[model samples]
Target chain A: MTEEHDHSGNPPQPDEDRLAATEFEILERALRELLIEKGVFTADDIRIAVEAMDRKDPANGSKVVAHAWVDDAYRARLLDDSKAAIEELGIDVGPAPNLVVLENTATLQHVVVCTLCSCYPRTLLGMPPSWYKSREYRGRVVVEPRAVLREFGTELADDVEIKVVDSTADMRYLVLPARPDGTDGLSEAELADLVTRDSLIGVTQPNAPSGG
Target chain B: MSDQEVAPAFTAGQHVQVKTGDPPGHIRTPTFLRGKSGVIEQLHGVYRNPEDLAFGGQGFPKMPLYLVRFSQTEVWDNYDGSPKDSVLADIYQHWLEPGAE
Candidate 1:
C-alpha cells in the first residue's frame, strides 16, 4: 500500500483531519423533517420505538439454549416450529405462519441471507447491522459462504457442511448454536456468556478457542 | 403507494429468471440470481412495492411477492458444498417467466 497505489491518485489520506461525529440533534431534526414530509412514520413514533427497543433489554437467545438442554420437548419444538417455540419467549417476528428456525452444530451449520430482498426478523433481533445489508456480502455469501464466514472471523474445517438458509415465505431460520461442551451444568447467565451474536448467525462455534 | 396493480401467473416449482441489470440504485435482488431458475416455494399475501417504499410509499395491499428457492448448483454450476448450500429469495411475480430450459 503506497501513495501511488491510491485509486484516485491523490495521496492516500483524508483531505482534512476534521472527521468528527455530527451532533445527534442535527440527525434527529433531519429525520423529523423527513418523517413529516413522508406523513407515514412520524419522528415521535420513531423516538418511541427506539426508546422501547432500548428499554427491552438484550436478547435471550441463550435462554433458548438452556431450555433446549433441560427440556426435550422444547428442543423438538424449536426444531419443528421455531417461530412459535421462540414466541413462547416473547419474540414475535414475521408476517405470521411463515417463520422458520435452523439449529447449527459442529456437523451441520446454517447461515441466513435474503437473496431476493432484505426480509429480516426485526421483531426478534434489532435492526440488522450494515455489513449484512451490503451488496458485497449479499453477492458472495451464497456463492462462497465459507469464505464469507471466514471474513466474519469464522473458519470452517474441511468436513463441516455449510448450509446458507435464505429468507423466504412459510419459512425463515435463525441459528440455534450447539451447546458448549464443558457447559453441561452451567447456570443460564453463565451459558449466556458463551452465546455470542456471531454464534447466533452460525459463523463460529461455541467451544472454539478464541485468541492466539 | 398508488392503488395500481401488476399481475403475473407465476406458480410454485416453475423457474422464473430474474431480469438482471434492470434496476438502478440499491436493489434487494442480487445480480447473480438474475436470469437463474428457482422453485416457487411460497406465495405471500400482499406487499407494497419496495420501490415505492423507498420513495415514501404508504399504506397498501397492492403488490404480490413470492418466496422462491434456488439451489447452489443452479445458481453456480460448480459449488463444492464444503458446505452443501441452497439459497431462497423473495421475488416479485413479474421477475419470472415460464422456463424453456
Candidate 2:
C-alpha cells in the first residue's frame, strides 16, 4: 500500500541514495576547496579540466591507428617516436608520460598492464576501464596473460608468443593490434570505426568488418 | 649524481638481474621482479627518480630507465603459457646489476 508496493506490478526498487565518500575522496574534495579558496585555481578551471578529460575517448586512439594502418611510413614513425607521430594527427598528448606503441606482428602479441598502479595512456585512450584498475587484473595479467586474455574472448594460438609489458615506471604503452584482414578496401574512417578501446588495451582485437 | 654525470651501465641485449631487497619507502620496482634475471631490451631515457619525488624531495640525479625483458617461465614457478612468452617492465638503472647470460 505504501510507495514500495505502489509500483503497479513492477518489482520493488532498491534504494538509490548515494553511498558515503571514501577517505581519498574526502581528502580530494578538501584539497580542491582549499586550493580554490587560496585562488590557486577557480572552480570553473577544475570543471573545465574534468570536462576535457571526460571528452577524451577511444576515438583519439582509433584515429592514430587508422592512419597508421593505411600509411606504412606513418606506422614506422609511430613505432619509432609515438609522441611526434601522434602529434602529426593534431592530437596533442601534452607533456604526458612517454608513450610507447607496441606493434603486434604475426608471431608476437603484446599486452599491457600496470602492476604497480593504473598508469595508462589517458591522453590517447582516455581513462582506463574499471577492470583495468581491478586488483585481479593487475595481479593476473602479467603472470597469466593467456588465461586473462581468454576471459576477454581473445584467444591467441600456441605458436604466438605473448609479451606482457608492465607499465611500472613513467612510460605508458598502447597496443597496436594487428589490422584485421579482408578490409583493404575500407576507408580510414570505416577502419577507425572497427577499433575499440579494448583493442587499444591489447585485451581484444578490433572488430572485423561485417560480412567482409 | 647529476643527470649529466649518470651514465647507463647496461645496454640493449645485455643480460642483467634486478637487485633483490625489500628496501622500505616508495620503490618503483615490483617485488616479483626482484632477483629475476632478464635482458636489457632498450634504454628508455633518463627521468627523475619517482622514489624521491613521491616524498616531495626533488627527484634529482635523474636515473636511466631501461625496458627489461624476462621469459615467463623464468619469472614464475609454473608459468602456464608458452615457454616463448615473456614479460617486460620499465626498470630504473639503480635496481639492476650485471648478470650471467
Candidate 3:
C-alpha cells in the first residue's frame, strides 16, 4: 500500500501552474499586435527592445559609482552633469529622463521614490525591483523614509538628515552612496564590487570591502 | 505655443506653495504636496504638460519644471523623523504660487 506522510506541519499548497493572463496583459498583447499590424514596428523590434532592457543591470551603475569614488573630478562631473558623466563611461542613457546624482555626505542621506509612477533609470540600472514599483513603497518611502530604510536594515544616526526625492516628472535620481570605511587601497574594479543595487537606490549603503 | 515667448514664472531659491485642487485628468502633482510650501531647488527647463498630453493635445507653451524641496515636518503633522528630514519633488510652474518663507 502507498504510504501517506503526516500533513500536520505542512498544509496543502496551491499548484505551481501559471495563472490566467491579467486584463492588462491581454490589453498589452492586443495593443502590440495592433501596432505591428499598422507597421509601427515589427514583432522582432519589440523582441529586441525587450532583450536589451533585460540585459541592463545594476553593474552599469556600480561602475559609475566606483569611478566616482576613486576620481574627484568624475564625482564633480557626475553631480554637476550626471548624463554626460555617465555617457563618458561609454554607457548609453538613451533618451531617458534627465539623470541626477545625489551625493550622500557625512551629515546627510538621500533616498528615491516615484510617488506618481515607476519612473526609473532603466538603461543604467535595469528595470526597478518589484518592491520599487509597489504601491506601499511608492507611498511610504516619501513620508517615512527613515522607517522604510530601517526595514531594509539601514539605520542612521538621529543627527543625519534624510532627504527623500520623489520622481514626479521628467527626472530620475541615482544616489551616490558614501564609500565604506577602510577601502582606500582598493582598486576601482574592487570598489565597483562593493556597490549594491540597494545602495544605488539609497535604501542601504554599499557592501563593505571583503575581509576588511 | 512657444516656450521662447514666455519666461518661467519662478526661479531657484524662490518660495512657492502648490496650488490645491482636485481638477480632473492626468495631474502629476502629488495630492499630499498640494497647498504645501517649498523652496525651488533647480529649474529643469520646459516640457510638454502631461495633463494636456494625456488627452492627445499638444502640450504647448511647455511649462518650466523645478525641483521643490519641502520639509517633512511641515508635510506631515506627526512626522516621527528628524525635523531636518525633507522631501523633494519635481513640480510644474502652473501648480505653484508665491509662498512665505
Candidate 4:
C-alpha cells in the first residue's frame, strides 16, 4: 500500500457522516435481529460474512497482478475472462456483480472511479480508501482525470493515454498497471511487493524496486 | 441467472449510444454518460438488473452488461486530457442503442 492507501492518515468522518454510519449500523442490527427471529438467517452466518470481508485486502489484487506480470497465460485468461482467471487462483469473487480487469499498457493507463456512488470490489481489495468514496473524487475523476491524477502526484507524459473506468453498477474494475522497468530479475513476491494498493486503483504506478 | 434466454444484442467493438430519459428509482447509468456514444469494449455476461435488486425486487430477467468506451473528446466538449484518451463505463443493455458510425 502507498501513502494514499493509508486509511490511518485519513481525517475522521464528519459528525453527520458518523451519525449516518451509526444509523446504518443500527438499521443493520435491527434487520439482522428481525431476520434471525424470522429464521431467515442465523447471526452466526452474518458474523461469518463480516469475517470474510475483514479477511480481504489489497494483497489479493497484488497477487493477481504479480501472477499476470510473470505468467502470460494467466494474463491472457485475466483479460479474456477475469472472474474465471481470479477463481483459478482460488479467489471466488462472489456470484453477483461481475469483476473486470483492465490492463495498463505502455500507450494506455487505466483509473477506476464510481461517480454515482462508492461501488467498489470490496471482496478483492477490502475497503476502498476514504478519498475514493469522497464526493470530490467521484465527481471529478470522470470529468478531469488527469488533474485528479496530478493531485495524487501522478504526472503522465502527453503520449500516454488515460482511460477512466467508472464502476457504475455490477461491474468492478481492477487496474493492472504496467510492470515497471528494471524488475526483470525480481521474483513474483518481490514484484507483488512493489505493487501498491493505489496502483491497483490506478491513482499511481507501481513503485520501481529501489537500487535494482 | 444464465444467459440462455436472450442472446447478447451487442458485441465487443460495436458502437452504442447510451439512452437518455430518466427512469425513476435506483439506476446504474450515470447522467454524464447518458445520451453519449461509445464502443462496446467487452460483454460482462448476464446478471440480474441492479435497479430491481436495489429495491428488494428479485432483479429478474438477466440482461447483458458491457464495458463501453468513449473518447474524452466525445463525452465532454472541454475535456482537459488528450483527445486520444477515453473512458470506460459499465452500462446495462437497456440503456444502450446502436450508435451511428
Evaluated with TM-score, which candidate comes out highest? Answer: 2
- Candidate 4's residue-wise lDDT over A2-114, tens digit each? 43554577774445744545777889889989999999989899889889888888998999999999999999999888889998999867763677889998889999999
* TM-score (C-alpha) between model 2 and the true structure: 0.93
| Model 1 agreement with the true structure over A27-125: per-residue lDDT tens digits | 977878887898978778888978755543225565676677567888899887777788786665534445566777767777887665565555565
True contacts kept of 4: 0.88
| Better structure of 2 and 3 per DockQ | 3
Q: Which segments of model 4 are wrong by more than 4 Å?
A: A1-26, A38-44, B1-4
lDDT of each: 0.66, 0.92, 0.92, 0.89
Better of 1 and 4 by TM-score: 4
Model 4 interface CAPRI class: high
TM-score ranking from best candidate downward: 2, 3, 4, 1
Check candidate 1 and list the clashing pairs: A100-A172, A162-B83, B1-B58, B81-B84
lDDT of 3 at A32: 92
Q: Lowest-scoring 10 consecutive residues by lDDT in candidate 4 chain A?
A: A12-21
Candidate 3's docking class is high
